[model samples]
Target: MSSRNSHSVLDLQSLTREQVGRIFSIADGYAGSDVSRLATKGCGKTGALLFFEASTRTRLSFETACARLGVHPLRLDGKAGTSLEKGETLEDTVLNVAAMNPDFLVIRCGDDLDLAALSSQVSMPILNAGWGKKGHPTQALLDAYTVRKYLGTCEKQKILIVGDVRHSRVAASHFELAKVLGYEVALCGPAEFLPEKPSVPVFSSLQEGLSWATVAMALRVQLERHETSYSLKDYRAAYGFTVENLKKLSAKALIMHPGPINQGTEMDSEVLQDPRCKVLPQVTSGVLIRQALIQLNCLEETL
Candidate 1:
């Protein structure tokens, strides 16, 4: 496996299906073990996690995964000094951090910024934590990992990703990866919420979409990214996965959300506790996949 500067994970679209499968192959072992098994593998190395957007699971889990691999984590949130607070450029600030010589850089590019350009200016490996509404490769990895963990495989599985397709990094990453990974994927939401030129089948009716899904993944309605006004009440009535509405899906259908869910908007609050809900498992999958990613990119030690 390539380490350091050579293996930057900017997005899933760049990786071959074999490369993605290898990541999960490494992750499978980590799932059965813990920090104690490989605690010192990444010792003497460091990783910088710089998020320009608000995050909870993605940031915290990457930090945890770094610890499990014995890689020291340096965190930077969306707080002061991360901005043009002193008129410094984003590239300049990132370059300054690269000078510190961390093993890799994990970054979340906000405001639709170009991560590829930023990565080109740096030498160390760059891991994209999330890139605005463009991509969330790791999230897609974990989500697929979660599905594989429960269902044995993701091949030929029908994943109906519903809501906010036009402005969801998760949805963007999932569909791009799905094409190569062999999962059948589609989109469901209001016309405005869906992409104008969709790569998959688009559905405006939630119940109809739910009927065909083996994995029902709901994306959060990103009001922060929306420029025009929309009605939450109308959104809930149309796209929301309520207790009554979800019964229309197959009992075997797995439910998921990327978190910070808008409860009554995209999904019912009670559904979070549903038996079929794989939300928490996705969190667990995040740690395993991330640990594997760190090990592959930062350490030369054999797994």
Candidate 2:
């Protein structure tokens, strides 16, 4: 939003090409043995992790990033030990957290809260962990980093994101970021699952999508977010990514997933074991990108 040392990464759409490059550059510096060396920079800083929804990968990686940087990660998982469930509004909880003056806050909010409104009320920097059904900017950053790490460049690369396109923040963020990052992204899913009028190409069949993509990112079906019901049997039969589906992918094509996967629905569990699958690699990249975010936002002056 503002210059370095004063801004929030609300969404990837708001990030500039140069800004994206800077984030990637910072992540590259901590890509390997350099992780433990940056502890001094974040020695006393504290970053708050305010997660309102259930999470596995995102939450843990952010915590791990803060630890690696030597920043104390104070966590308040939705209503667990906090007064949130006893009727304290998310906005009020955030305002209360802000009053304590943490260096930065990594928030994962539910659909009801207006993050932008709450963000305006805070003094500390805010990083959007997950943005309703709109976008997951940090996830996009990590995914982009993984792509660069694997393919050496993102320019003109093809990534076909398969399954549950309608409710996936991951797909929305990546598709939007593609415009600035110089890559082509396609969406493939059941008719109800796909967006009604996506700017990018859409495919109904997974096989057809894999034929054109160098990266196949299978998205988890968001039953929690869906307003209408659909048949899992029918959906899986048509769009499930399995080892058998891997044959359609080119030798160099990468397979990815934003995890906590629906074992037999979005993809078969066995597909995760494939050598070309980069889901775990994506998780590893997530930590480094978050470390970069922490440095840029929490340890701003040192950079």
Candidate 3:
């Protein structure tokens, strides 16, 4: 553990397998602890959250997590009069905010910006909420937490991650984390949208991948600020997980999505609400996992 100013979660790959295991243990402890006691334990003294991109879940969960720990959360979303609107560079903004000496700074930026470059400019601990198409470490933590909660442990659990790997930060981190946690991982998407030679097996069709997986995690099709001339219907037909395709999953298999789910594009809305779906649990785990992260970082400093 380290002070909020002394730590940064840039990517899941930066964390060792042991550290990931410990994070889960801490998250479990936090999840099981008395809610009333959590605030008094070490609540509001930690730090703030800085997000440079649009977010509903991660931003709010981090704020709630800091509040539970009795720490103040200074939220920085781009708005009128924010330095960002003044055309100031991200480096300058981060440096200026770092000078305020907050306990932690959590950032979600769109460009898949250089995290190490940003980290170098700020002394405060940095956590990547989402960084371009690179990674989302905290999301990976919560995803792992969700899997462990339902499936007992990730060891040897067959997992399939489907959809646009070419543009998903969550997918990339989830794939890497699943592998590190000892799950047999597979990926499926259109040939143009898949990663180049991933460590795990890769498939071009959902039906083919579904045969081998005990869990299927789908990533939403990202339609960011840019509108491409791509065909949504074509993408849906080829890569989307429809109700028919959902039935192909193992009876014991779980369905997951790192959401703002595109109802008719990447997944069927009906499938999202399926009994075997763990999407809601993934959202719940985000708060607890973040709380555990803040607590563990503080504990490290004390040790």
Residue 30 lDDT, candidate 1, scale 0-100: 87
Candidate 3: residue 137 Cα off by (Å): 0.5
Q: How well is each residue in 143-254 modelled by candidate 3, as lDDT tens digits?
A: 8888889888888888888877778888778777876787777888866567766777897678888888888988876556224656779877767778887777887878
lDDT digits (tens) for residues 46-132 of candidate 1: 999988778899999999999888889988886576655777776677888888988889998775567788667777788889987
Poorest 10 consecutive residues of model 1 by lDDT? 1-10
Q: Rate the local accuracy (lDDT) of all candidates.
A: 0.85, 0.85, 0.78
Pairs in steric clash, model 1? none
lDDT of 2 at 66: 92
TM-score of each: 0.94, 0.94, 0.91
Candidate 1 total steric clashes: 0
After superposition, which runs of candidate 1 have C-alpha atoms over 4 Å from their true positions?
A: 1-4, 81-83, 301-303
Which regions of candidate 2 fall more than 4 Å away from where they truly are?
1-5, 301-303
Report model 3's TM-score to 2 decimal places: 0.91
For candidate 2, write residues 232-301 as lDDT tens digits.
8887777888777768899898888888789898888888888778888999999999989888866875
- How many pairs collide in each candidate, listed in order? 0, 0, 9
